[model samples]
Target chain A: MDTNDYIVQVQDLYYRYDKENVLENINLSIKKGSFLAIVGPNGSGKSTLLKLMLGLIKPQQGLIRLFGQDINKFKEQHKIGFVSQKANSFNTGFPATVFEVVASGLTKKLGLFNFLRKTDHVKIKQAIESVGMGKFLDRNIGELSGGQQQRVFIARALVSEPELLILDEPTVGVDVQNVNSFYGMLETLNKEKGITLLLVTHDIGTISEKVTNVACLNKNMHFHGSAEEFEQLKINDVSEIYGHDVHVLTHDHHHHGGGHLHD
Target chain B: MISGLLQYEFLQNAFLTGMIIGVIAPLLGVFIVVRRLSLIADALSHVTLAGIAASLLLEKKFMIFSGLNPLYMGMAFSVGGSLFIEKLRTVYKHYQELAIPIILSGGIGLGVIFISLADGFNTDLFSYLFGSVSAVSRADLWTILIISILVIALVVLLYKELFLLSFDEEYARATGIAAKTLHFIFIIMVALVIAASMRIVGILLVSSLMTLPVAASIRFAKGFKQTIFFSILFGEVSVLGGLFLSYYLDLAPGGTIVMIAVLILVLAIWLKKRAATRSI
Candidate 1:
């Protein structure tokens, strides 16, 4: 890969909790400005890998680097944004307006005890508009639909003007129609704004069409390549990556074991 | 009713101090409630009882009761207990809730021993138990004021960080917010509020001030900022109203204040349900 191609590099990463290995010997490199989707079965370490990449969790046995340096050394925290799978993971009844939640993206860069400035306000407005939520800026977050709430979170992620936006299963609980629009908007963001996108989802029907790259994962990674390569892979290969083809066939219709049904 | 406040300095002090704690505690409570750490505050207040009991016992044993006040010692013990909880929480990272019962039991056990040793059962320890407005001094007022200012300033400076963490700790940590440090600072602040509140609300009822207003606020507030504001507003109303009623009824101020807060909480929940029904 060329110098400008790669934005994230992980090598031989390992993570465990309470003597249970969550991630096992994972190695992956992601291209800058590329849209990547990570698909996996439940408890497949997809979220854990993203957490490690974002430096939320430490690798027990291997090195992970971002932007050509160790993630631990990266001081510019404001340059990246993340949206967890649970959009409602935050307080569903928290007292903030959509605008305030979105503007919180700039919290790290603002001076201590400083209220938002005019430029900050302008950027927030821009972010709201970017997510087509300008009309609801002052509305309470709890009043929003799941799709709209997810959009607000996306706006929160975008308000920082991040170079990389990592969303973990953002459309999991959204309606099928909303999922289509959400993916469309994300594709626009990746192509129009040149924003590097890393999304984790179990839904392959839509993601396989839109994302440029795909990574299949279980406790260990199985595939990391272009989406075209993923489509060409045999059913046996897909089954090996996901551990079972029935799971993928039934995922859209049935509820997985103890997995939260997101709203 | 207003004349009562002016006629009794002790009453005035109680009302003022109670009002301050009323606002600050519930303000802090919003975060705690959102973060599901409401019970932690309850545990810490109980722990503070041990500190107060120990201070009383120490004062009696050392015979240093002349010019020195025991409240300072109470505050120090409270802070120490707060730090102890923080340390324990860190040590038991996955089982954080377990720290609450351990510290609470330890504090209460020590409190039982100290209170027994000091023979403070029939004495003015009732003021520390159910809460009496008559015990607050000018010094206590000053201490409450300083702590209130510190709480307000810290909330303002770290508003976004706290908001982010309260909303989603994993996301906040993922984005490089020092969530651990913030959590420690928050618990310490809460401990200070509980300590400061002990003189007015008493150890038994202090956690009620922290919880009831938050319960009321969550009924109406839609998001994070409104919850904070509404919680403070609700707390102020409950405390001031309770103070006035306490004076009229000649009851324990802490008990009355917490009772009033509970009433308001019930009223708010009722009104919310009514509104929901109407809308439906």
Candidate 2:
């Protein structure tokens, strides 16, 4: 909430896959308890940036600081939660229950060999309740719908009681109706629970409405500022980031209403 | 059945070994089937065949060969093959399944060469190829018992890490669970099972024993651990039934075991369909 509360800080970060450079000279800082959205077209370094922050991939150059220490040196992995794109990104037939999936969030805190404790159960219950998946705890994870699966993943991420939550395309395969509720639930977590949110998505139309800050990237950053600044962005700037003339009809009541399909 | 099991030492050894494989195969197999690495087990079994053939070819006629105990050498070869497959899969990335054919064909080809060089396929080799309870030595029993403990201990100690890596490797890595190390360990474990099982199930049917129980259990089991439990139950039935039928029917134990497992799989599928219809 305070400007001094910096949770993630990236300075002059550079990354390359083979010869092609991505995320060059990337500089950004995320404040604690704020929802930040990383938006750009395909091939942009948005996903790469998030991966660097989560230490999934190492940057070619520059420093990433999380909670004031070098990202590489930070060992409290449990304090951060990650949810990838909505394609499951896992073996679909894996026979784990929603409860088991959620319980895995404690892997870092509980370590590899120890069994889940009583307090772990309490946190798991709290997480499932938060995601409105309390009733489906015993159901197999693969049996759920896309939106329900996303909620279970969210619960899994939340069970660790993370200070920072990073999500990549969380609503990609989710139904249009469910996306609204999903974002609303995320908004509540940001507002009430004070969890810092970093989301990577291409859908600016939906997420721009709720995000506190927005960064538009295209191999390298094109724009970085608050959501209000992003809303007031020039059409040329948006077109440049997308590498084409882009038009998205702004819908004001879309977030408030039950559902709106934007195809 | 109790009297039948006690009447013969070979029967006793076969039955106990069957029970052990029954538990270990499906316990590991559930993860393998879900991970879609079942074919990898098949590839590794062929590699073990090559190893066994090589061991036989190298032994002199006057030297006196130990029948089933040579399987330890086969296990070492299979574990090496597993590591090689892991490396090939990593290097290829997109066409990772390419590793399967490469290993499978190479293994089978080398096995044929080794078998030819061994001069002749004797009654011992025939039993090994098709499965034989008559070849169960005390040393073989000790090896099975020791490998079973190692497999069980490995699974217990690394249960969460293994499960996490199998389902979502990226998430496992993100969570700092050492996914790559765990994956290598799992492949090695699968290799060990394949090597140890080659004598009982033979190269032709070892993968089936590892996979059929998993397929049957997944139809009705509600969760991951439950599926594993049901797979062990199904595997136990298949192994014991197949062993008894092999003895009574005078058929190859490996072929009979696989046939029984396949039958159970079909029954499980039919029952699942009936359950769905009734629910509707």
Best by DockQ: 2
- Residue ranges of candidate 2 with Cα displaced over 4 Å: A1-4, A234-237, A240-244, A250-263, B61-68
**For model 2, what TM-score does chain A reach?**
0.91
Candidate 2 lDDT at A79 equals 87
Location of the lowest summed lDDT over 10 successive residues in candidate 1 chain A: A254-263
What is the docking quality class of candidate 1? medium
Interface RMSD, in order shown: 2.0, 1.1
Candidate 1, B27-138: lDDT as tens digits:
8988888788877777777777887777777767777653456567666767777788778878999998888888778878988999999876555677887777788988
Residue range A2-69, candidate 1, lDDT tens digits:
63467788899889999999999898888898999988877888888988888877888888878777
Give per-residue lDDT, candidate 1, residue B211: 84
Stretches of candidate 1 off by over 4 Å are: A16-21, A241-263, B1-8, B91-94
True contacts kept of 1: 0.74
| Model 2 DockQ (Cα-based) | 0.75
With candidate 1 superimposed using the best TM-score fit, by how many Å does residue B195's alpha carbon deviate from the native?
0.9
TM-score of each: 0.91, 0.94
- lDDT digits (tens) for residues A184-228 of candidate 2: 999999999999999988778778889999987777777788999
Query: lDDT for model 2, on a 0 to 1 scale?
Result: 0.84
